[model samples]
Target: MFDTMTMTKVVGGLCGTFLVFLLGGWAGDIIYAGGGGHGDHAQAYVIEVASADDAGEVVEEVDFSEIMATASAADGEGLWRNCRSCHSLEPGVNSTGPSLYGIVGRTVGSEDGFNYSGALVAVADVWDADHLNGFLENPKGYAPGTAMGYNGMRKIEDRANLIAYLDSLDD
Candidate 1:
């Protein structure tokens, strides 16, 4: 025979479990919907490239000097703040990433005495303005297995500014 107390306890436990699941789902929704951060800010949407043609591959492109002229150093400094956590501008002061002393116009993965990822070393060429822009825009895509864990900058303006800032650091 089921007693009244036993029935009440069983019902209460079931209700509690259901309530927990509901609350957890609600919290998860809130977190994801908040744009991965807790602030009101604009985000640059990514342009997906499904196919080689859809990827906007240009076989022959005309020179666009206006884009280069519009780069802003101040804006680049603003963007560099995000990188400061892993990199240092000071000479011989390496952090999570290598110290970025005179990084602009220098050979990629060629920082003396720094341990670089093989992926980065693979792209050991000059980091010209155009190359830096592309790399900053998408690190993983630029170098398949680079140790730099940053997702590329989505906004063109941000990449330009960041490149300008880096350029100014030349020795």
Candidate 2:
């Protein structure tokens, strides 16, 4: 049979552990609570995030024609590494996205077997140089609601180069 001293020691040990846990929790709340004020105090530091519009102004816009004139298909082949996971450059082979073969002048949403979102079809009829430039620059922006998950090439040169590479695919 267990003695009362052992019972008392067990109870005391549990109570001490509980007390320690409670105090630790209180200390953590005080350290990490970030000043519980009702919108009275200003933030300690203001973070200045450059807006997309401001960034656009800082970077001079490059004309699609200029980029096309200077774009390198060799560099574009390297960039195509990003697209290879989702798209196939081969004709009639669709992967996560439709085959990009001959995409430069092809009709939007016109791949034979790939299922395209309504957004792409509604935006433009043909994927001309200018249209491709805009779409490759920002897929979601050019065609809102498009299922293509690409964030888009930020550099105009990259877009042009990619287009040139794709154009070469069919030739």
Candidate 3:
């Protein structure tokens, strides 16, 4: 025999559960459609522009092309004598250091069939005049923990001349 009280209790519980689910779904839809009450875009800091007079004086740009164009490979070759102890400038030759032949525009640690230091290998991007200049100025600074034992070139002109010499070796 079904009791009326028990049946009413079961129906009331079911109705309460259904109402909770329906309200939950409606609340979720309202929250989703309201766009979270946040701005459409993020705000950014505004950089202030300085006037020409307020900025530091404009320095004239020196043309290094003329200087590099006139630089002699012979001079660079002479300067490279310092590197001869640890490196060779000839192709297919690996000395204490890797070959310097055609190294001006080559990658930082790109000598084939040679064991390069992990420090140098970490930065294998292409080497150009500016990169070589920085490396020659301070090899350790340029590529920290590099194996090259030579101290950096002190003078910028020396680096330029060395670069000119290295450029001549390429086919």
Candidate 4:
């Protein structure tokens, strides 16, 4: 049978212990902590990274034309599966997206029936390889407010292959 007074003493002891531990933690942190903010301490030595601008070296930017020169339409046919859900390869037939039938060489925003974002024609006159490359790399970035909701293909090879596959469709 524990009394109320005994219970109070036990509770007080536990709370006091907890407070001591808490204060110890606070003091220890104050005494042993590292500099609080980022870049507060001097770096010993920066490992020099070879950037394009550094070391009298210039990086030659590889154009997509060079990449597309080696693109494979056969492999690109596989990439077409991802587009089939929203686009059609048949000419004059529109899906959620307009028919990609002659898209590669076709005029921008000129796919007949399907209404485009009106931002595309401002970017380019035709859907040439270079234009298509930039568009496929970033739809919204290239056209600003295109209706296409695609996040865009990041790889140059994929864009080139897909462009090649679309080019092969009209031929």
**What are the models' TM-scores?**
0.60, 0.65, 0.59, 0.70
Report per-prediction Cα RMSD to one decimal. 14.2, 6.1, 13.0, 5.3
Between prediction 1 and prediction 4, the one with superior lDDT is 4
Estimate, for each residue in 121-160, the C-alpha lDDT of model 3 and write its tens digit.
5655888787787788899988999988878888666778
1-171 in candidate 1: lDDT tens per residue? Answer: 789999999999999999999989888988888845668766578786598658666665524245668888888999998899999888778888988778877778777667888887666487777777777878999888888999888877788878788778765
Task: Residues 108-167, candidate 2: write the lDDT tens digits.
Answer: 889999999899888889988899888888899999999999999888888888888888
**What ranking emerges by TM-score with the best candidate at the front?**
4, 2, 1, 3
Better of 1 and 3 by TM-score: 1
Measured with C-alpha atoms, the lDDT of residue 150 in candidate 4 is 89
Report the candidate with higher lDDT, 3 versus 4. Answer: 4
Colliding pairs, model 1: none
Indicate the residue-level lDDT of 52 in model 2.
73
Per-residue lDDT tens digits of candidate 4, residues 1-171?
A: 799999999999999999999999987776668523343678779897886666786557888889999999998999988889999988899989999998888888888899887889899999999999998888999999788898899888998999998898886
After superposing candidate 1 on the true structure, give the runs of residues whose Cα lies further than 4 Å from its correct spot.
Answer: 1-65
Candidate 4: segments with Cα more than 4 A from true spot: 1-18, 34-59
Evaluated against the true structure, the overall lDDT of model 4 is 0.88
